[model samples]
Target: MGDVWAAGDAYEDYVGRWSRRVAVPFLRWLDVPAGKRWVDVGCGTGALTSAVLAWKDPAQVIGVDTSEGFLARARAQVSDTRASFRTGDARSLPLPDRRFDAVVSGLALNFVPEPHLAVAEFGRVAAKGGTVAAYVWDYGEGMAMMRYFWDAATALDPAAAELDEDRRFPLCRPEPLHQLWADTGLDEIAVEPIEVATVFADFDDYWRPFLGGQGPAPGYATSLDKEHRHALRDLLSTRLPTAPDGSIALTARAWAVRGVAGRPA
Candidate 1:
């Protein structure tokens, strides 16, 4: 929970495709204004933060996360002088009151232990009328790639039933998210589902990323003993479709929620 391995493009290879196609578009929908101060919570590797930095032209853009390893990578990837990366917790941010005009996160909200408090913190840090928007991957049936993986895994080994999609993809549906916004005191909250297409060339291209041990599913696979890992790999490869021309296409979905920080009641 506290650390993520940042050794290579292994994380980038698989996760990056999804980030570019799904996460980026959902984040951009917030339409951050020029010269505003923006904060990106859980700014893993600065992928979403850098995208915000580019799109918003903010007076300053701060990227905050818990991982020193992720911060190091973020520092390297983001070259903007107006941007800075720091180690911080979302539940208890270090910044002062009403410090930002906008706050946004991408695909990191679900992993937070107390998402409600995190949302409240977003409201607290955002100035009056400032916007807070976040994106999380839709789980199970909505996200085709991950759904396919779990489906294939369960068929191979019922013990894999422990790997249910609901646990990870909590915001896949809208009701809980809408209620969360109301509980957090966000005014005029709205939620939208967005899709991104992920493309892979051949079996090796898709399989290698799971071996990287970056995110949750990949981390689970990498933790398995060699025999189990091999068995899982064989099951997945056999189950997933392979294109005649050596390409695979999968769709991923994210629920993007946005709202304004209304005046205190």
Candidate 2:
């Protein structure tokens, strides 16, 4: 339940695309100035790192993650000279204190075990008055695609409801996110929702990602036996809102929060 990340390609195939969509607006919301030093904690596959390099024009952008597979992918995919990827724990980042002007994560905070520790690490490394921000899927209600998948999965197997992200990660909601930042002693704390269009070309586009076994829903899907997996998939097919043109358009919402890192107590 703590860390499901493996097979970076599979993870990219599943949610990396949507995470990139969220990253653009999330960066815009942060509005950090160009040439600032930035670090992306738990930077799974470098979604936010790439966004920072492209949009923010950071002086330097270091991406840290526990998953070597993801770090390798980040290095290969994000080819900017200003960016670098390293393997590091989110709860104990491998960096000097107060080195970065911006510390940001996207679609990753909820996946870190003891996420508060990771946020504390973010505060520990961010310069005073620097931006400390992150965004995560509102798995409870705002993330429609996963909501559809889990709702269908649980309808067929009521016991599977316990595996749902809405039940498992209480931190993905706005109140909890805001509180976590407050508890970290960050100033000017605020939270907002970021929604993006997740239009799947067809049912195959949506269903195949679940077979990737990267994130939670896909991990649960791949755990089932062949027949049971097929049953669960068929159930999802019927329940999803598919357009007559063989497309499925849904929205994903992530709660984004930001605060200015303050001096240590």
Candidate 3:
């Protein structure tokens, strides 16, 4: 199974904690209303789903992911009686049509083999005039931390170069997102760049998560043999700057997008 959710622990340990924090403000920006039903796609650990529940007293919040292990952890983190988690694929949602008032996804669309189809499903589930918004990590040169690590790691092993940042973070620029929104038949499309700072207590705090082998960078790290692992680690450490207290601070970009579902009349 290609289920990325199987990588739950490493995801939460490394990117999950920071990624959730960064997405909080974007959810607020969308103005999700109270008492509305919500679906959080790729809701690893329920971070974005939890954020939605916190702001809007949503009538219901369903967090969907492909990894049962991730769903288990997400269930534990979110104590809201109104919230629930499910294991499912993004391209095909199990919910009824027009059953939700809004659909919100975060940092997840990039991993889908067909993001456009997933977006259409998100739109399909939303009630007419309902909102659909999403964000993804910018994996190009400006994404910072991942960029730094990948640059260093790939240099050590040319074979580890198939990471799919480009396909996942495709909305980094405005034109592509604008085109995607149009293609999806969504109206009022808006796309913007959001910056988030990832803080680590130390370089070890930053490096430790890569050992989890959950996501792309971690997968690369875990795939290496003993000799290559040490070299990759050393190379990353050299590339990432350390703080006086031995912490690391890296910045990342998220492409935030929003639009209304259905034909743009």
Best by TM-score: 2
By lDDT, the better pick of 1 and 2 is 2
Q: Sort by lDDT, best first: what order?
A: 2, 3, 1
C-alpha lDDT of residue 128 in model 1: 88
lDDT per residue (tens digit) for residues 162-236 in model 2:
899999899998899999999989999999999999999999999998988898899889888999899988888
> 103-138, model 3: which lDDT tens digit per residue?
988878877888889999988898888888888777
- Candidate 1 lDDT over 10-64, as tens digits, reads 6567576577566557656777668999888988778877777666678988888
Model 1 segments beyond 4 Å from truth? 1-8
For model 1 the local lDDT of residue 39 reads 89
Query: Quick one: how many clashes does candidate 1 have?
Result: 0
The clash tally of candidate 3 reads: 3
Model 3 root mean square deviation, Cα atoms: 2.1
- TM-score of decoy 1: 0.92
TM-score between candidate 3 and the true structure: 0.93
Residue runs of model 2 more than 4 Å from their true location after superposition: 1-3, 263-265
Query: TM-score for every candidate vs. truth?
Result: 0.92, 0.97, 0.93
